[model samples]
Target: MNRLTLCAAALAATALGAPALARAEDGRWQIKLLGSGVLPDGRIDGVKTDLIGLPAGSRTRADDNVVPTMAIEFYATPNLSIETICCLTQHKVDGAGALAGARIVDHVLILPATLTLKYHVDAGPIRPYVGLGPSLFVIMGEKPGATAKALGASRVTMSNELGLVLQGGVDIPVGDGGLGINFDAKKYFVDTIARFTTTAGVKALETRHKLDPWVISGGVYFSF
Candidate 1:
């Protein structure tokens, strides 16, 4: 079985073996440590300017990444909470469609700063929740790939922008001592401008891209 399948199986077995949650979650604070998967759609929305002469119907795709994530939450009420997460994910941008198999950018680092307001449902054992929030995609660093260097791109940069996040998750209580297993999913709607600069620090190309990503995570939580 794959690693993800193993993780899901282990989580299921643990949940079934544990006693059902009998009390409402009213902890004033909670924290989660998770392993997350970031899957992005880095398609070119529009080409503002292209000095590299991109082919017709050319598209770009960002590779998926796995990273460690941490979240801190404050419970304002029994059913309401405020939460935020921290993580840095890395991806590679590659050409698709007409320019398939071409690597355009490499080692792009993204730090997703996110905050959400969550509402928990009063399920019998599994605590289900939904949340919405704002996020900022901070592009820390980017390097030009082989293809970009061949096209005379000496530098690469992606704009940092604000976005929205829609979230959903379930918390399965593992024990009575404020411990649980959390599986969360967040959808991000964001975009950015990718600039390819020449050796003289002049912009050679600029393209608007859609960076919508679905971040899925699984982890253990502790309430205090």
Candidate 2:
């Protein structure tokens, strides 16, 4: 009789453990840190040509840039979640030949923040995900060489920006209790539609730029 009771208890334990293991495989929370390299086009048209001139109407170029970002996510369901990310980056513009001449055109800080809705696909220990969202950007700095006191060809204060962000990535599980490695990519669809204010007046200019930048990074994720 005792042997039969022991066998029944063993069966019940296995049943309970199986369901708990299944739940752990279902839902989770994640976080990521991004290291990115970017390139910018620093050109302004429709302004006073006497300040800096390349051709009649030409654009300026800047060097490649590097930036860092961070994000947090909550898994509302096993395959769905919401996320937000923030980044800091710098930009510059310079003279091309006898035109504007050589100088560190601008030095400023750029902050782009975004919110996204994500969907994940289960593929063994590795899961892949994709998302879409909107973003807000603020650019503060100046151009390379102007005598005007405000920016004087060295800075521009502000820009009101509207943009879109698209993202995709994967996660790999490492150990127990929701520890893993994460990877993701993001793109910002934006344009420079800003007006510079000087003693002359407000002038509208369009700055050409790159839209998609590659991001390869790793961080930690915790499950609740």
Candidate 3:
């Protein structure tokens, strides 16, 4: 009777261990679809120009945007993963300080491509993770608004940027399968040059714009 009891215990352990092992090894790829709200929390400085119509010592502010974001994650191990994130967003630039209430820059599209190495802590149904990586900030589609054009500014141009990205987030598993909810915040540190053009004869106004933005996102994740 004791031998039969031991045999039953061993069979139960094997049955549970087999399923757990299979679950751990099967789902290595994950895709996340997120909605992100971008907030620019940096300053624009070093405004210099030869034009006379614009205000002296003027500064700028970047507007916010809510956009769709996506990421693909590959788990190299149970605790370590690599993820790539991308979102294309448009931000408006308005004058601050002396030039307040004036829209000098319009419809600037920012495309951020980031790659991160993440370390996750497994704590039952909720997993917390932190990541650090590099990002490429591609600035394009800049258009000068009416106020800028009237001030002899014919074009708005910004240089592309490369910077460091830091992120932290949590994942809450829904069921036994590989579906979960993810919430994260990311910070980008990038500095770029902005130049404003005038008529063909005048030298463009150049300034250093610090575009450090904080992005907060939340959405669904699926692993397969």
lDDT for residue 108 in candidate 1, whole number 0-100: 87
In the range 74-180, model 2's lDDT, one tens digit per residue, is 66677887776666566665655444544434565555656777898988878999998877766655443442233433224445477887888888878876777
lDDT of each: 0.84, 0.56, 0.78
Q: Report the lDDT tens digits of candidate 3 across residue range 1-224.
A: 34234333433332333233335464387878899999974357566654555566566889999987777777767888777777777888888888787787877877776778899998887999999988888788899877778778888888899999999999898897999999999999988777888878465677788889999999999988
Which candidate leads the pack in lDDT? 1
Question: What would the TM-scores of all predictions be?
Answer: 0.87, 0.67, 0.83
Quick one: best TM-score, which candidate? 1
Model 1 residue 2 CA deviation in Å: 28
**How does model 2 score by TM-score?**
0.67
**lDDT (C-alpha) at residue 42 in model 2:** 49
Candidates sorted on lDDT, descending: 1, 3, 2
Q: By TM-score, how accurate is candidate 3? A: 0.83
- How would the candidate models be sorted by TM-score, starting from the highest? 1, 3, 2
Q: Report lDDT (Cα) of residue 99, candidate 1.
A: 80
